[model samples]
Target: MNASVLPYREESLCFGPESRLIATLTLPGDHPDSALPAALTGSAELPPPHPHLHQASRTSAHPAAAGRAPQRRPPGLILLNAGMLPRIGPHRLNVELARTAAAQGVSAIRFDLPGLGDSGFTSSRLSHDEQTRAAIEDAMTLLSRTKHAPDRFLIAGLCSGADAGFQMARDDSRIVGLYMMEPYYFPNRFSNMFRTLRRLREYGMRRSVIRILQKSRFTRRHDPAADSAPVPQAAPEEGVRAAPTPQHFAEDLRSLLGRGVQIKLIYANTLMGHWDMRHHHRHIFSKLGHAPHFDVELVPHTDHVFTRVEARRHLIRGMAAWLRRIETQQHASAA
Candidate 1:
């Protein structure tokens, strides 16, 4: 398989002189002529724009629009948080995902947080919350000034970036949809641990396990022969945490569902109970119960980064299918 270098345009937009963000608008150079028709005809459901969704008083002038049914490019702005270390999983994943979205007639823009990337300082230098909020504002401000106000906007992130995306959608209803790859929540781990303890009686050697745990001195050595039983560990993914109490994650979920934003979250199932444990799937699903506006899908046999070629391919295909479904639903509703 050949990996093509994505082509993009660079522009700087500032919410404030000292608080500017930089982004690269990238797309595949050799998009097929067939994609336009597919994009327009692919009848899929689209979550309605939030009341706060904004658009510029302008129209697009791209070639595809000239011969189509008022085709408007879907523009997405990706914001990365500076609070975490830069890694390949998210950076490469976004690059590839953005390129794929663009090939399918979507426009993607990714920028560094205020103090991260090419912008300035480390996340520790400033308030993390403030930086995330400012990043969202910057992304939104950029979307408003696009050649054509983005007909659709999707926000995505990884780890701290995912946290930032969640906060952004909560704060700004303009973000119609959210695609969080893996959101890292630290406190969720202890919750899972306690829950596991409650089920200890199911295992015959529960007393022995507790004894071992109580004696921290004996825990220093890893005894493969200690027991064939399983132990709770952090999720093995790049950025994930153990499950949190349903009540604890309720605020974030409410923030998302309260604004009526549809969420499409994808993660590796194997990451559960490990370093990247994320057991809020049921909680999120229950919170969104009976809400026709939301959809969720999980991809198995893939790691957080989607390093496997097949995993990446599946991820892209799933995204395309979801987008098409949304479009179909929107047209049918109008008719």
Candidate 2:
């Protein structure tokens, strides 16, 4: 295929302090942006953050900045590293999602924070969580400089990555969307019942059936792929918080909703481990009656790490669909 006709183009980048952080930038091709609504692809424009920075980004030396006039940042997403996993994500899930987002006319960047993947550790005094927040802000700044992309941003993360994104969203107004996969879920009165159903009936019976089949030599041995995704790393050493109190969570979430921020909680399974259950947010949103901007999803029968191909497919599709919905609404409201 010709260089210009490719569905999308990806370029490696070294940005942040001393230009040491590693990141990959993916931008949509001409045809890729055609299908997405103008809202999702960025329609209205505003002036760039800085006149000098705007001029620098328009220089032809950078592919992302090249060929576009200085304008307000377009809509984009920041794909954070899953815990300490590289920016590519487990099984390169981040790469797949970035390409998918590109196909819809949005740009995406997957970057390594200090000490993860190819990025080196920092000597800063800030704690890890604080560093993560700063790194995310730096990513947005990088986009503003490199691609003019960051007016309204989205973040996709899993586990610890999800937690960090959640904490950052509370303080960062630029963040307009968040995908928190297996984010922390505080338990409620229904927690024990859900655990019983998941453990004895859901898990125990399946194991029993498998054991019976193996004893009778009637079925092939069942083996699952190894999942190397982060396993609940220790709580944030300082600064950033892991989980907020239920009251604080409800308050903060309501505030985000008031600001039109979209939230999607993607769980690995229905009522899986960690005292969580489907419809777990009733206590939080009960008085609100109906909040159009909030929702929950469960990738049924998947493990915590989402090793299953089908699970990841479901996640990517859900993300794309949600992005379209939220962006369309945002654009309509802005109009």
Candidate 3:
């Protein structure tokens, strides 16, 4: 909310075996206790130093070691790639969010997953979910070496990245919160109807009705000959199918809430294919209405990728507000 400017520093970091990942760490230079190791400076061309450098720098820059009382480390925030768009996010959204968050005392990292952006491909034969979890763990390990030594973290992502963050939070206890933007979800009947009406209103009723009638006819007239000719056995479906049913997703959310993990689900108005508005979530996941830790926010007049300038500004403000609220709540609980 304050327009005050805070100085910050940025450094490129490489992690994982042979330094496979290329990540950028941003710290609030105004914070006396916030300092990064020299080895993490510059670009991926600079090979990471020994593990001892992490420990030595962490110890020397720690507030307690400097004769001051140990300060509680703010929860680190990690921004993952939205689909394959890279860590900068659509229209450099992640970069702006990280810089704004840094000014509020929240250190942030934006990184590419293996084979995305500037990061190297992962040689592991594991599934995508496994690879995502490993990538997040490596990022956490790197963050732990900083002067803050943040014990807890928040992971934010859009679309596929949001899916990865949700799965990771489900598996790892260190992940305290999740910011999911336009995450994949199955549309319920009410959601479907709402989307239809919204489209009709936006595209003019006559055109929408014509399109819907045409689509219905196409679906009903599926080639009878092709249907009868498909005697060959088909291979089993590979790769993850659509996300679980709404009930199952609700169960997962309940489990996370039981673990005291906070979650924020943001839906762009333009994301009518999956979700349209707040009630869509309530309609899909009835139990979510009772979960205080889970929240759903709707950003009106914004596309899924948030490319417009006003949309980007609204997103950044929403993110900053959420981070500040969570940080304050955590500090209060600790006190």
For each candidate in the order shown, give its overall lDDT on alpha carbons: 0.54, 0.72, 0.73
**Candidate 2: lDDT over CA atoms?**
0.72
Instruction: Please provide TM-scores, in order, for all candidate models, with all chains considered together.
Output: 0.61, 0.73, 0.75
Q: Give one digit per residue, the lDDT tens place, for model 2 in 172-192.
A: 898888888888767677778
lDDT of 3 by residue, 40-121 (tens): 3223222233243222221232223567565667888899998778889999989988887776677788988888898998
Better of 1 and 2 by lDDT: 2
User: Any idea what lDDT model 1 has?
Assistant: 0.54
lDDT of 1 by residue, 1-335 (tens): 12222232223333322444445544323323424533333233322222321221123222234555754445454535424443123436666666556556555666666555565553344565675675556555555554434645777666456666776676666676777665543335466675456346445476758765877766677877767877667655334444445565666666677666667666654333332333455544565566555655556766666667887677667666755655665566557
- By lDDT, the better pick of 2 and 3 is 3
| Clash total of candidate 1 | 16
* Candidate 1, poorest ten consecutive residues by summed lDDT: 53-62
lDDT (Cα, 0-100) at 253 in candidate 3: 84
Q: Assess the local accuracy of residue 298 in candidate 3 as a C-alpha lDDT between 0 and 100.
A: 73
